[model samples]
Target chain A: MEVEETRLPGIGLRHDLVTASGRRIGVVSQSTGARHVVLYDEVDPDAAAATVELTAEEADAVAELLGAPRITERLSRLREQVSGLATEGVPILPGSPYVGATLGDTALRTRTGASVVAVLRAGEAIASPRPDFRFQAGDRLIVVGTADGVARVRDLLRSP
Target chain B: MSDAARLLVELGAVVLGLGVLGRFAGRVGLSPVPLYLLAGLAFGTGGLVPLDAPEEFIEAGADVGVVLLLLVLGLEYTAGELVTNLRRQAPVGVLDLLLNGLPGAAFALLLGWGPTAAVAMFGVTAISSSGIVSKVLTDLGRLGNRETPAVLGVLVLEDLAMAGYLPVLTALVAASGGASAAASIAVALGVLALVLVVALRHGHVLDRAIGTGSDEVLLLSVLGLALLVAGGAEAVHVSAAVGAFLLGIALSGELVERLRPLLGPLRDLFAAVFFVFAGLSIDPNDLPAVLLPALGLAAVGVLTKVATGWVAGRRAGVGPAGRLRAGAALVPRGEFSLIIAGLVGGAVVPEFGATVAAYVLVLAVFGPLAPRLADPLARRLAVRAAERTAQQRAAP
Candidate 1:
């Protein structure tokens, strides 16, 4: 992935990433620790098509959306350190086995070595999600463990 | 009817008229400044039906409008940014002054308004409307453009320069010549420098004073603080606008941001009233004689302002298209110009205010629209230049 970064002299840093499908995603990290996730115009990349301001928590959630956690330096080391120990997001699609089920009901964290550490819903991060949290379709579960454990958790989530 | 009752009734009608006109402007996707000004003219003395009421209240409200406009503008940048921008953009700022200001001064002198009027009109033509330009940027969604920061730099420079310029002009226009005049001008400069230094150094005093709450107390405190400072400046014979601007520069961080949403609506309402008061002060009959001059100034205004943006944007390494956009963006002259014209009063040529009002009305309407109007033209020129470059490369 090619990400272009520029320092916005006196303001902060701006980073732009062009996804494989040619979607240009921009993130402006302010000096004040605020972040603006800007969607650029498809034709004119300079103009912002949309700008969504994110709180600290939501910005972390967005990091997960970008694939691996890439916000802080420790997170970057975690990406390499946990290589095959796969940290991945599994979506709770409609008609999936996990729909309407509680995290405790899944029992998959115990069954497989994968731990559901966080849940992303409605653009919010529920960090260290509780066992009692309800599983809803469109919920993105961020799981961390061995590849085998993550695969098993994915299967558990997909099967109705 | 009693005098008070008639005044209240007339004021009510005026407010209603402004509201309706503002709504219409919003519906049609235009700034309501010109419309509001025209409505003020209609309701003013020497118009079709002048309002027969106490206008003292409106006059005071208009003064508050100027202070708030500058204050909010100052709130847009931090004191540090102001200093850095002024230093970095000094050359462009000077060029902008020379290009845009020279014409107005020359025009005033050529029209035989004398050196004093020439100086006053120079201030009028030189300063761009930070208020109107900001609105236009937001409205056009050009806040993220490559050249916007450059445009903003130019505006900030103009504002900072105005802080000193207004005080000196106030002194000059107050008295044509005397040792007392020199003494007052020096005093004004000293006060301005003192405020700037205090703002730059001990601004945290203001920060702590403003507190964190975003309620009515915070609102009243902020408003009161501005008025107190503005009043103090006016007492010292400097423009109250400078006082408010300096105060805005002193307050920064989260407090400024929190104050914005609370102050936004109030700023708009009072700012509209301020424009109306300006229009009311001008007689309609004087506009015709000045209209031709106003038009000529507008034409000159475009060239000088565009040249300013070009120098600024090019120096900042912006492309031709972006530079052109910057130039057009700087075209509108609104609040500050009117305030300067107001300051001069009848000291200059009798029709000075009329000329300024007409000039501003022309530019205020034209300024915001200039960028959008220039976009396609700039793109075409850019495309042609790019084609030429490609042809040259192919031949080689």
Candidate 2:
């Protein structure tokens, strides 16, 4: 978990850490927002075995893909433990009335007895989003409740 | 041919020639600077074919080139990073100055070029080519090396030194009297200090002011402001390049990144023109005479730079091989060296221009290859150390 941070003067900052497998890996975050993933050579610790340059968008996608799935897996495990309890992902469409509004504005829990547990945006999970957590188009809200409550929450989200 | 038509034709040919030269340099894995100079020399006075482009156009372009070069250089770091590098590497930077600069000054004095030429030569030899060094690191996949930060630290310090040195040298070059020169240096330093303060504390305010607006508007404002400040600084006897550099430092935040791509092509074009202008100013005939001394200075330059890098790497706690790579990485003297020589104006010595041209030519071409020497050199040293240890064991 320990990482070494090195400032590259005019270039950028590099943060490298050694994995449990004895592999040294680093990400150089450049001033221009590009990221370079560097794997250090075992024979020569000073040199890199491989370097991958990623654009800002590509880096975001990589981060999202790496992070988002864990939340889904944990939630899916909980769903298996309870027979009546259910979870459904409801995405905010462009035409939805609450697209730009906060989660509080919907009051889905009061209306349908379903709780919005988390919001997934760009592969990042915002857990236990507060009332004021704003909704953006394409945000996937994880609603958890009884199967009927979850289906009603999804219908409400799709319409309003 | 009409003057306008002839100018267009000549300018078109020159631009195309530069493009070809640059491409060839790229293919050969060399900095295009030396090749640009060669192209300039070929078309300059007493070469294969004289360029018929208006003198004023090239002069103006070259002037803008220096400004853009300095501006872009300053934009590479924030004021905080500059301070951090200065704080951490001050000793190494000073060593770099003394070890590399003194040789050039001594050589100039030995050549009977006097104090002014010594000052000029000091700048020429002291600074490493950051452009070439950075490219070499990227090319060699050494950007992630342990010694790279140390190498880059040395370069940052050198650049900071140049910001201060250029203004003082400009004052010295312009003023004949000792009192006036001293006064001018004081003024230059005062302006420099004031600008640094503004860059550090009030940078965000300037950023907000200059950084807002569309790309076109931002580019125009920044470029216009640079020219205005450069002219103002020139009027006050500070180097115009320093003024542009100060402007770059003052404007920071997200704008710096955005401005980089917009200004990059502009910087490249003008920078090439600056190199060519430097070459055109030097006569090819004068090169032969100065070649010997320039070569001598270059050899000394290589050693001193290596020494400087060695010290820098050691300070950063790099091992022997990494230290050698660091040392070799600091050997090239490119744009800044030429800039110093150009600022010298050949008033100090008749051969100053030619000497610097040859010196830069040798170093710029050789600098890229110098890093390759690091591994072999390190192995040789290791062998010698092993031999000495074995001899000691045998004696006992």
Candidate 3:
């Protein structure tokens, strides 16, 4: 699980890692938000056997697909370990006050003392979204905190 | 024909000719610089069909080309990257300067050019073409290689050095007396430092000033600012190209990314003109006399450039094979050398332009081939390393 990070100067950054199966993978992230998943050739090691380019949005979608389950699983384990801690999935109805607004605009954590762990939109989970992440109608937010804090978050989302 | 119509026809034809040459270069997997230079020579004085109508326009376009070239070059890296790479690769950078620069200086001295021409030649040979090198790395899919960062570090350091070197060269070229040259150098260096501080500390203010969603507004402001600053720098006797470069450094963030595509085509057009103008300035007849000297210089330039990369790659902990790749990647010398030639303009030595033009033509054409040639040697080194590793395992 050790990744070597190399700065490409003008280009961007590249993170290279070797999997347990001995496959060398490199992800090149350009300054302009272009990404390339590079698989190295076993024979040459320095040469890329295959490189798949991804746009910024496609990269985010791929990350969301891979990230959702693991984050929720970790949260569920934390819930089991704590006595009063709760993790709840709160749905954003069509008329929620935060709908179509950024995650930061809601000020949900400051208002309710609950943290948003992830967002579930159209059955896809986006984990650990930044403040800039926008909320949409029909999106479900995963809130984690004390039971009271979680209840407050639910109420806050429903409030006009 | 009316004067305006004549200018339009000649300028249009020259640009169209350049476009055809560029396409040809692309098809043949070569840089268009040499081809553009050849085109310039073809239409220049004493050539097959000498052009007179658009001479003034070409001259002006060439000036803009140099500015835009430096500006775009400065935009390639942020100030942070420049500082970091310089910190890490300062030794390699110094080594690069000595190894690559001295040969050209020595060659110039041997040719009996004065100290000024020697200084000019030092730059012509020292700096590798970052544009060609990067494009080669990308085209070869070597951007993901272990040795690439080291290669890029060397290029960045060379570019930063140019920020300082260009002013010195420009001052020396402009000043008639040694004392005046010294004064000009001091003033240029002072202005350069001022620009650096502004670029580093108040870059955000500049970013704020020019940050706009509208492409047209952003493009016009950046270009106009670049030209204005370039003109101002020229007024102070600092090179206008350096002024454009300083403007580029003072800009950062996502706005630079937005400005790139808009500036790219414009830069390309002007840059092409600059290269052709470099060729146009030279007499092809003078090239024959300097060809021998240029070849000798080219031989020295290739070895020195590779040596530079070898040292840099080793410092970065790259393996022997990867070091060769790094060195090979650095062999091409292009626009910067021509910029030096353009500055020198045969003012120091009558044959300076032809010598540099011939030298660049040789290297730019053959430098890209260095990496391909190094592959076999690199493969052998890799095999030896694998064999040694296997032997070590058996010994244990």
The clash count of every prediction, one per candidate, is 0, 0, 0
Error of 2 at B340 (Å): 0.7
By descending lDDT, how would the candidates be arranged?
3, 2, 1
Report the alpha-carbon TM-score of model 3 versus the true structure.
Answer: 0.90
lDDT scores of the candidates, listed in order: 0.83, 0.87, 0.88
Candidate ordering by DockQ (highest first): 3, 2, 1
Tens-digit lDDT string for candidate 3 (A52-141): 889999998887677766876887889999989989999989877677899899888888889998988876778787999999999989
Residue lDDT tens for model 2, A98-127:
888998989889999999999999977987
CAPRI-style class, candidate 2: acceptable
Task: State the lDDT of candidate 1 residue by residue for A45-149, as single tens digits.
Answer: 444568777887889876767643332333336758866777778899988867889999988778999998778788766667788999888999888888899
How do these models rank on TM-score, best leading?
3, 2, 1
Candidate 2: residue B335 lDDT (0-100): 91
Whole-model lDDT, model 3: 0.88
- RMSD of candidates 1 onward, in order: 7.1, 6.7, 3.4
lDDT of residue A81 for candidate 3: 96
